[model samples]
Target chain A: MVRVHNLFLSSDGYGAGEGQSLERPFGHANPVELGAWAFGAASWPNRTDGAGTRGLEDYLVRDFHRNVGAEIMGRNKFSPCRGPWEDHPEWEGWWGEDTPFHTPVFVMTHYERPALTLTDTTFHFVSGTPEQVLERALEAADGKDVRLGGGPETIRQFLDAGLVDTLHAAVSPIELGGGSRLWTSPEELDDRYHHDVVPRPDGVVHHLFWRR
Target chain B: MVRVHNLFLSSDGYGAGEGQSLERPFGHANPVELGAWAFGAASWPNRTDGAGTRGLEDYLVRDFHRNVGAEIMGRNKFSPCRGPWEDHPEWEGWWGEDTPFHTPVFVMTHYERPALTLTDTTFHFVSGTPEQVLERALEAADGKDVRLGGGPETIRQFLDAGLVDTLHAAVSPIELGGGSRLWTSPEELDDRYHHDVVPRPDGVVHHLFWRR
Candidate 1:
């Protein structure tokens, strides 16, 4: 089964910033504190003797990383490039050489661009409906789990299609008064997502949900 | 200066997770990986020259620890305590004897609890409006910058009040499908935040945003 996982940051009640530039996206207060708490798990090398992190939070990060074979993200995540792809030719994979995603990354964009093959990962731009991208992702993932790495519209499309099976949501303690909304209402989800909370050493919370 | 900062993970759409419990709160994809990262960073004694950390991520961590005189968070952040004060009593800080917020932490809660004096830090619960909390935070912070520790609601209050002057939001590559929305559409602000993007060797984007 393809396990579609969506990740995001929480603003007070608004969608993310209008221009999701690399510089400022709702201005996170403490990136280090948040990062240490959120990603300070197994994926990165542990400076400590594997102490301090909550067991549950560590489990979720590992589960997502280990299970994910392929990822599909909207063009917004791939780059700040918008409008026709021809306008911005300098844009490439956000991660210069060593991207976190070692597997294949499918970018959902309207513009046509050549596939980018990096040292460990490749970026393939997919046009058309999100379903098309998911199809490509499934093919790329083979039997492994496919993650619907998103930018809101992309994940909503997947969720609307009833594609995601499991989701792990991290609720950071900060809110952007107004920018973006994760889910307008729970009804958007066809069925209830099993919910659980995983605490982190940095005082953040991770909410996990999976379809029954 | 009192520096209010917000830290949280993004759910593919800038929203935080919900029903944060012991099971899933912080975005830990893998348990083992999460453990290793936490342990490594927590093993502060072992971090020699911080050379082991990958690139900008290392700098971001170092910067977080280096800066900030004191830390402040909400009641939810201090402990998993719920309901009125009587419901949950005698709750010590989360880190036991050696809490990470070695600096002073001013927790905002309705119930009044005795101050917790730990080995390296002290926990004081302040019950009042956001302004009152800010005053106490400023006093506690003294000349040093005050870290606005989280639990979304609290951070939102501070941000809405325009208490945060500088924010360093590290946009991790992962996405959470659904949870708590950090920013919503209704809330609006006119302040301009400046940012500088620092790419970590690990592909994490460290965005440092400051208000001019």
Candidate 2:
């Protein structure tokens, strides 16, 4: 089953802002504020510094690592630069050598680049349709489930193609004035998926969608 | 404590649909589906029929009568006809004689008409700015909170003018492809209000906004 876990969006359903750059990966929006809930959750395995909040957010955050073998993300999520990567040849992504994915990470891009390995993660730039890329990710995952990481546009492509089986979106209280929108109306998902909404006391709404 | 209780919207933040007429008050949208949560809630006073479901939806529905003395709504909400009412001269409103609102109901419209009294509810058409109309509604509400009944545009006017102190919107899982939007980005409310999100398991996300 293909799943999207802990994808943060504004109250207006925007996944990311416009004109994203290296400094502002989420464009005009604040990534810190948009993802504050997950980072603050006690169940986050990546949090090694201080104690995090224990609640629904923590439970969801902790689920990010369960049974996930490979990740498929957009080129934009891999690098802020658009078009060709020749201009910023030295760029290795915002994660540097400490990329979060321990499994194979496939990046869908128009401009292909050599596979880059960092610690336990390997960034592979592959160009294909959502199905084609999913095939490669699934093969790389062996028997494990593949996670569809997104910057909104990539997730939208998968959603439009009906390739995703489950999606978990954390709707933050803030609204991004303009940017790429995930969906104009989520009710459209009702045709293929069953929707569940869990509201956290801290002002974040977790929207879960699973295939019916 | 001006509060908007049980206001239903699409996940995209649409309160009502475009080209709303007497035949379709919610335009292309289905009122039964958009407001199904409230109708099923056990606490809804309007539900005189059998029993309703108990839980958060019920609690919010019951809160509709808490301190609400009077109601303010747009002319569109009262009647389907726009511009001059001369074309649809006989249109009294879709609510018929026994309207749900038992309080003094004020309708803001350019076309002034005599007050129509129905049961405990009286529809009074008045023309003024949001603040001006709110003043009258507040006076009519007396010590109770004034409920800003809407069709999206009307609420947007009040929200833009900063007349609304608090708003509670239920974002249903369904999506209306086209309609009047309540807000471009609800985050703008952060300047004067604090926002909270509570998602019910029934696929409705309840957005609570209160004056800071």
Candidate 3:
């Protein structure tokens, strides 16, 4: 199954901003507010130190990587570089040598780059249709589920192609004013999915959608 | 205090549709789905037959009229005739003589029309800014709260003006592909209000906002 887990969105449905740069990945949006829930969750892998919240937030953060074997992301999610990749050969990525995805990670971009291996993670830059890239990731995932780690545009591509089975979105109680919108209305996917909303006291609502 | 109650929106934040007409109050969108929660609530005064759901939906529906003594709406919401009032003399409104709003209803418009009284409900066609109309409505409301009955644009006008004290929106699971958007994100109101999300088993999430 292709599942989108722990994707944070502003109340306006924006997953990221328009001018995502190396300096401002979310473009004027405070990155801290966007993913504040996950950051405050004790189970976030990046939180090796004493940081994050407990309970549902922590459980959800911890559940993000469970039973996942591989990941597919947009090149933008991998790095802020756009158009061609030759301009920034020195840019390894936002993540250091020890990347989060321990499994094979395929990055979709028009510009092709050679595969780079870091620890258990192997970053493979590929240019193809969502289906073509999914095929490779599914193979790498073996029988396990594949995770769609995104910058919204990548996840939207998979969603538009009807390649997603499950999606979990954490909607923060803030507006970004302007950014890259995910779904204009989740009802656009109603033909293929059943939606459930889970509300929490922290002012965030968990919108879950699964294939009907 | 001005309160907006029982306003329902799609997950995308559309409260009504564009090109609203008398035949289609919510434009191309299904009016039933947009306000389905209110229809199924036992508290809905319009529900003559054994319709509406029990519990929270009913409670919220019943709460719509609790302290409301008057209503403020845009001209389009009162009647389908756009541009001028003289264009449609025969046109009363989408609601018949016995309109749902039993109190003095102030209709904001550019063209002025004499006040039309029907039963306990009186429709006053007045032209003024949000603040000006609000002044009249507040006076007519006496000591009770004034209700901001909307068509999205009207509610947004009040929201933008920072006049609404309490806002309750029921987000239906269904989506209207195209319509008038309510908030780019509820977070736009975060500067002045606190937001709360309450999920109901009916596949609708109740979004409550109040001035901080």
Most accurate candidate by DockQ: 2
Better-scoring candidate (DockQ), 2 or 3: 2
Q: First chain TM-score in every candidate? A: 0.80, 0.96, 0.95
Ranking by lDDT: 2, 3, 1
Off by over 4 Å in 3: B1-212
Tell me the tens digit of each residue's lDDT in model 3 across B47-94.
778644433455467666767899998887778788776678877777
TM-score for each of the candidates: 0.45, 0.51, 0.51
lDDT per residue for candidate 3 within A1-212, as digits (tens), equals: 89888898988888887787889877777878888878866568788786444334554676567679899998888887888876677777788987888999999999887899988899999999999999999999999989999978789999989999878888999887777777766667778887666677778887777776
In every candidate, what fraction of the native interface contacts is reproduced? 0.00, 0.06, 0.03
Across all models, the iRMS values in order are: 14.5, 9.6, 11.0
Report the lDDT of model 1 for residue B135: 80
What shift in Å separates residue B207 of candidate 2 from its native position after superposition?
22
Predicted structure 1: clash tally:
83
Worst 10 residues of 2 chain B by lDDT: B50-59
Per-residue alpha-carbon lDDT of model 1 for B17-69, expressed as tens digits? 54655444442332232223222331232354533422112223434444577
Worst 10 residues of 1 chain B by lDDT: B51-60
Better of 1 and 3 by DockQ: 3
After superposing candidate 2 on the true structure, give the runs of residues whose Cα lies further than 4 Å from its correct spot: B1-212
Write the residue-wise lDDT of candidate 1 on A48-167 in tens digits: 455333223333454445556799887876876677766568777556777778889998878877899888788998798867778888889878878776665667677667777666
